[model samples]
Target: MKNRPFRERMGFALEGIRTGWRREASFRTQTMLAGCALLALLVLRPAPIWWGLVAVTCALVLALELLNSAMEAVIDLLHPGIHPSIKIAKDMLAGAVLTISAAALVVGVAMVVATGPAFLAEIGL
Candidate 1:
């Protein structure tokens, strides 16, 4: 099959998210959390650059999780037997998701810390 263009690839990715949101509890939870975090960022009015970092990092983690899920699905479809190579591939992809999630958490905390004082002050705390 010919490689899909970038726009087509993005469309497929959006479709995956739509399907996942309907079927996957974890995806729904993460999306809900992302929505909450976005609201906080807007209400708190964090430094513009830090807000961008947090938003991008959160999106990256979610995107990585989606890709990891797709990888596992393809591996299972290709080889239903117990295969060390397939196990390794799936584990590595999962590890990538973990790493990205951890990084996103760190960035998110940093953004909150950087802006928390101002937010509190504005609230008359």
Candidate 2:
């Protein structure tokens, strides 16, 4: 697989994204929320640095989510049984995803708070 062409590798990644969108509710939800954050950034026109910060946070969340989903799938395929070690591993994966998600939320909130006056003025509030 490593020897495959770059095009093939990108196609595989796209397929994985499609699978996540179709099979994982959390992935779909996070993707939508991330889209909203990006939309907010577009509308608000915050600082240039903020664009990078927000984009990175959103990408981190989706990437972590995909990693979490891929690992859980592997665990299920290999074990398919209840075990303490597997449970802890799964819990840690969940915790990691949750931590990044929370960080993304904080970055989003900070962006809004920093742009509050401009946002309000634009919205006629």
Query: TM-score, each model?
Result: 0.84, 0.94
Instruction: List, residue by residue over 28-47, the lDDT tens digit for candidate 2.
Output: 99999999998999888999
RMSD of 2: 1.3
Q: How many residue pairs clash in each candidate?
A: 0, 0
Whole-model Cα lDDT of every candidate shown, in order: 0.83, 0.95
CA deviation > 4 Å runs, candidate 1: 1-11
Error of 2 at 109 (Å): 0.6
- Residue 117 of model 2 has an lDDT of 92
